[model samples]
Target: MRVGIYLDDQGRSLDVVVEAARDGAKAGFASAWLTQFAGWDALTALAVVGRDAPGIELGTAVVPTYPRHPLVLASQALTVQAAVGNRLTLGIGVSHRVIVEEQFGYSFDRPVDHLREYLSVLGPLLRGESVSHRGATLTAVGAVDAPGTKPPSLLIGALGPAMLRTAGELADGTVTTWTGPATLADHIVPTITRAARAAGRPDPRVVALTFVCVTSDADARRGWVAQRFAMVGQLPSYRAVFDREGVDGPGDTVILGDEASVERQIRRLASAGVTELVALPIGSAQEQATTTDLLVGLNTRAG
Candidate 1:
């Protein structure tokens, strides 16, 4: 199984993101992922990381499709891919209504249809082809060729049924967060796998994200984790995943313990069919570094 690190580029500076991504690559991580929040744009940060770490695979765990046009996004992704030598992965999503509607001043109604249309136009545009189509959500005419290689593999951040089906039919894979192996095996994996097979495509890659804090003390670990969970539990979409997994909260899914325990947790995810696992380290800098090192060491497992 491939292991990567997911960096929440919310409050961190661009330099910090680049430094961490460089550290991840130097430590032998397979990839470095950047997730969108309120601050830096995902592609922008990824471009910086791409320039800073030449060999590392850079990705956006998710960039919402509501605000930006698909062609614009595809062009930006292609640019980053060009800079990084085809080591860029694009993960796009229809974000929550609160953020899309309340934050971005966009309509949240019929997001799935919007995404379907976005991908229909996005695919060809990213592949250096002109796309002129009229869809329920997006319409475009002509395309400009960006100075880049072929398009990066497109992954959709999806949890719901319609989104999952769309991901399987159109995208290269699915990127998920706030989901444990139980929920993944029982719900997410089956849904996406079924969609891919039904579409006559090979099994789509399942990339799962989880938080980890490598600490020896139980209370310290639990306390550190509970705080993170408190924030995640407040998100309705994340709450559903926790509920499906029979987890009381984030602590139930977080990998917090000694090295042995954390390693076992990762193995569990692999058994559940997670092809790529992205670990988000939450805690003090030291603890985060420990978790990062542990993940780097696991790259040997791929050998």
Candidate 2:
């Protein structure tokens, strides 16, 4: 399985973020992903990073779909692809109700339907095809013109069965967070793979995102994670995933241990049919460095 790092660009400057991605490439990571937060735009920052960090895949662990129209997103993604030599993976999703409805002032009703319609419009546009879709929740009436750029690989942040089915049928794959190996093996992998096969598409990529910390004191690191990321377990989608995994909170899903133990858990994820693992290394600076080094070593061996 391929290994990647999730570069957190919450409060850092664009130069700092680009340097981080450059460092990730120098350290031999296969890819570097950025999440869309209240800070820097993930795709824009990646475009800049790609100019300096050649040969490394750049991705958005996800950009929320409600805020941007399909045409606009396609234009932006293809522009980034052109800027980055076609090394962009556009990961998108219908974010939680609280954020979409409360913050963005968009309806969160029938989100799976929204996702399906969104992809229906996005896929053809990314391929430079004209689209005239008029679905229940979304509509598109034009095509993007990004010369010399192919469609970047598309992934949706899908957790439930319906969303997984839609992702399989329409998108390239799914990007999941707060999900564990057992859930991937039993529920996620099979559901999406079957849907993709039934839709006559190739096997889908399963990219699992999780927190990691290489530490001798596992308990202490887990406590740090719980305190730092307590809000994650409260989000409705993540809460459902945690319940499905039979875990109590986000901390329970983190890969926290010494190097050997961490390697074993990551191997379990690979065994569970994960095509790629995007790790968000957490904890102290030393612990994060240790975790990243372990991932770099694993990536080298995989290469």
Q: Provide TM-scores for the models.
A: 0.94, 0.98
Model 1 local distance difference test score: 0.84
Segments of candidate 1 deviating more than 4 angstroms:
228-231
C-alpha positional error of residue 154 in candidate 1 after TM-score superposition, expressed in Å: 0.5
Q: What is the C-alpha lDDT of each candidate?
A: 0.84, 0.93
Candidate 2 achieves a global lDDT of: 0.93
Q: 119-175, model 1: which lDDT tens digit per residue?
A: 888888888999898877777787858864878889999988888899998888899
Superposed Cα deviation of residue 113, candidate 1 (Å): 1.2
- Cα displacement (angstroms), candidate 1, residue 58, comes to 0.6
> What is the Å distance of residue 303 in model 1 from its true position?
3.2
Which parts of model 2 are misplaced by more than 4 Å?
Answer: none
